[model samples]
Target: MENRPLIGITTYLERARWGVWEQSAALLPAAYPALVQAAGGLAVLLPPDDPGRAPSVAARLDGLVVAGGPDIAPDRYGAEPHPRTAATAPERDAWESALIRAAAAARLPLLGVCRGMQLLNVVRGGTLVQHLPEAVGHQGHCPTPGVFTRHPVRPVPGTALAALLPEAELAVPTYHHQAVDRLGSGLRVCARAADGTVEALEGDGPGFLLGVQWHPERDGDLRVVRALVAAAGG
Candidate 1:
């Protein structure tokens, strides 16, 4: 394995009156870097505004991690915004979509969380359920903020996720209202909630493409990060 795998993490864009803030800004929780570094990988932030530099960005990294953030623009998948939809950034969405496509074409190790997972699905020609509470008839994933809960998920055995986690029953913190409605091509659902919402997906072939609905970073689930780094040949 390489001395240290360089994992490129995608960042969100924030707008300020003075200037355009592009880094992680204070809004996002700061647990990702700690978990990634703890898992023996070097974390590098890739701003969504830097789509023009994705080739160079990909060149310097061994793997990619698409972090959670604002909701993706509904228009990307040929839909209108739902009342429950929060703020949407078109530029960020476009840039991240491009980056996801490039990463997939290059066959790099990728892990998407929350919104990142939705972006990955859309990039692969999938659609999303705009509002969960209105459509799915649940209280929604994150009923409370700044908290974590245990929701049971059944992962398909013999899948990459099952192999990595190995737990027949798993509980993860969820804070998403939007979810994958139609999976992308060449991807298969590896896990799901009791309500039948898609919870996890993996690349059909190989190349280490995995996306989950939960915030593994928040829970210090280093196995996800480690699995990506290992797939990167670290």
Candidate 2:
């Protein structure tokens, strides 16, 4: 049997209805797992669990993907909630935060998408812009609610991200109302939108730690995901 790299992906806990059951359920878009599988990895859904168990969970996997979800609690990063900020997910926050820390500790290959990207910054003692339109003077980043928009991000030359994405600028599916205001420790900006919104972040230290503000899964662009899978020795 082939030993595919195991990839753990974080999931959302929300009220959902299917067939006759209407209750809280562990939720994750199929695209996430699909992307991992396409990148030659074994997808594992990680439902919210006790934060203390993160180290054990991370130890069982070769790579980790922090799936996108609702906004994180502003208080996690020592900031008050903004009026336009979406409802925060405290439980998810704690669980994913723990997982991120564990993954970094173990030097596991890691990727963060959308909200996941924002959480990475917060986990490392950084701040967020909260509402982006007010700061950027435009709604192009996330123009329509629940609909992903397209915009170009300029990758900083000589970055891991830039190396993966050979193009000077790449348009991607984006949907976010907040962005990294203060970069996290041991992390550096790798890409940015035309408005200067931070689009991609990478670890300054070792490991395949990366956080992308855009939704690479939404477009089936496997370059980033494949990078992680390859880094995991898949």
Candidate 3:
């Protein structure tokens, strides 16, 4: 793991309060960067910037990570917003979507979590279920807010995710109302929950392109994050 790869992770451009700063701030949970650093990658924050700069940002990083955030606007995928869709982050949607495209074009090792995962699906001409509880008839995937729940996700055999996480089933940190609906082009569903939620995806393109509905940063497992760093180093 010499020559630690530099990884750029997207951030949340939202209002924050810390030490008298109650204004808009580029923020992300420390868990994201902490996980990257623990996995031997230098973590850098990629805040909302002009979408046009995504290519240049992608070119400068060894790997890219699209972190979780608010729900994407339904319009992005040709759908109307569901009542539970909540407020959307159009700015983040535009910026991170651009970054995802840039990363794909460059074949940069990429990982998308939660909202990022949904965006990956949408960017690839796919769609999402705006409300998982409505579709699955249960809220286990996200039973609470500001908290990470746990749910079992079985990896599809012979998939890259299966090879990386050899466990028969993984209980992952979950917190998202949306899930992938239509399968995205050039991407394969790599894992699923007992209730049939798409939990993970992998692309057929070069390098590594993975999207997981759960939050690996919240878990102790480093396999997934390490894999991204490994691919980046190569």
Best by TM-score: 2
Residue-level lDDT tens digits of model 1 in 1-234: 448888888776664333654444423356877778888888888766657767666766789888898788888899998877875667668777877887877887899998888999999999999887776787657667656566878898889899998988788878887899988898899998888888998888968999999988877568888898888863
TM match of model 2 to true structure: 0.98
Query: By how many angstroms RMSD does model 2 differ from the true structure?
Result: 0.8
lDDT of 3 by residue, 30-97 (tens): 99999999999999999999999999999999999999999999898999989889745788999999
Q: Which of the predicted structures, 1 or 3, would earn the higher lDDT when compared with the native? A: 3
Candidate 1 wrong stretches, greater than 4 Å: 15-28
lDDT for model 1, please: 0.81
How do the predictions measure up, each by TM-score?
A: 0.90, 0.98, 0.98
Could you tell which candidate, 1 or 2, scores higher by TM-score?
A: 2
Pairs with steric clashes in candidate 1 = none
Which pairs of residues collide in model 2?
none
lDDT of each: 0.81, 0.93, 0.93
lDDT of 2 by residue, 151-195 (tens): 999999999999999898989999999999999999999999999
Q: Could you tell me which residue pairs clash in candidate 3?
A: none
